[model samples]
Target: MSMLIDLEHVTKLYGNVIGLNDVSLQLSSGVYGLLGPIGSGKTTLINLIMGQLRPSIGQVRIMGSNPSWSGAYLRRIGLCPATDVYLPNISGLDWVTNQICLYGIHRREAQRLAEQALALVKMETACRNPMGTYSLGMRQRCKLAQAIAHEPDLLILDEPFNGLDPVGRIEMTQFLRGWVKQGRSLIMASHILHEIEAVECSFLLLTGGRLLASGTLSEVRSLLREIPNQVRIRSPQYRLLASRLMGLDEVADLRVERELQQLLVSTDSPAQLARTVAKCVAEENIQVTEMRSEDDTLQSLFSLLMQLHRGER
Candidate 1:
């Protein structure tokens, strides 16, 4: 459980604009997701770790060494950039082989590794196609293959699912999950909450270049404990159901949306309230069609955190 990446009081500035401000965090070996909106310093943080940009203040350490350019610490790390800037004229196979060579592998070994990487990304059939001929999703897989060609201990991906369709996204998610099972570490930056939730073992949320929250999904939920949990109940007798739920001490608020034929119930304790409601249904002989929790999604969590931050400002 040693720290793979560590940042202490890390600050970055672009003249008058703040790229990152007094950010400090630690990452261990696992699939960690950096979640944030655009311009929230997600890219800046990744650049700092990659040694592409020096911090204005504080320190950045990757594998116990500073991550500045020429640090040599990057030898143990792999990077998949967010932008599509590959050599347009070169075929995917050639491009991957060239990058492996840059990592100091011999030509024959590099080619072998490149082919294996392509196969891992399911791109072996399309490996000889020129970069320009590949679709955005195909290009992303090619980039991922290149990043893993050297078999580095850690992999950093920025917007890895940026241009993928739904099926492609699912494939990418499954692939990353499998990669982490090999005991390697991965740090992925993404704006899509559902995608991050699917891939992330933990989360580091950023907003306006500042760290908002960091931890597992359950930990993040605890941070928003003040907010009531919501549930929707649908029954044949909506009015009767609403009246009974409203009488419970566990229920803090209730709203009946007549158009939807559902009753929205808010309670301070979701687990306890669910049990109470379940008992009430049995006692009342209510025919329940659907019962579900609302606003439990990661998107809702992010929205709530952003709103809280805005109110503080």
Candidate 2:
């Protein structure tokens, strides 16, 4: 399929500071998680895609054309920024309808679409409430309503899950999943990995003003197989298992965890270690109650990537 968005050796700088460096990526039609910590150039990349900021070097394309040419593609893209901005005097319905109307939608049609969008976000009851009186979560819903009210082909959201309670987050995640299931595209950026993980498995990893990696989580883990992983095994015969693991070159180190009942094995190849562990269990008749890895979390993966970047691993 054709690229929905593309950046080629894109570099953005603010005087002495680097916003993005040597970043090249292509996003097709699908939901994606733009994962990074704060100040990781996530906003800079989004702004570049939105044509709000011109890159210092290289190119950015959305829908096979430059996003800087706003009029040519304005109707095809929508953005929900992290910051909240609303006219305090206007009702939520009025705010969303006015936003839709700015895109040349008719007033009556805008209102109709706004109502539908609000209902989709489960904010129908508060649609008529004044913006100033709405809670933070309700205001967030209004922003989402405006973004999707026009039914843009690609929706770009910055910290979209912010201001939502746990239940609201779950509902919004499901709503986004359904939206993508219908073949529309979404790019959501968040500092919190699990929030995005709940909605999309594919990710764009960024840190220190540069693109680190971009692919499915499994693909990224595969690419970083050189990074040592710690696996916790709770076995009745912990000492015997440790001895067997120590004999293998794949196992780099070992440590006792949660007393002597559990052994944490460090290995360069987690997949290979898993296979070896299974073989050992079959041969030794070990009663292993549980097995898990500390490196499974996105944070740990990010740390490993950072370490690789720093030549520490």
Q: Report the number of the highest-TM-score candidate.
A: 1
Q: Taking the tens digit of each residue's C-alpha lDDT, what string does model 1 give over 39-72?
A: 8899999999988899999998887888774667
- Global lDDT of each model? 0.85, 0.86
lDDT of 2 by residue, 71-183 (tens): 56768888899998767889999989999999988999999999999999998998897888988888998899899999999898999988898888888899888888888
TM-score of each: 0.79, 0.78
TM match of model 1 to true structure:
0.79
Clashing pairs in 1: none
lDDT of 2 at 82: 97
Candidate 2 backbone collisions, by pair: none
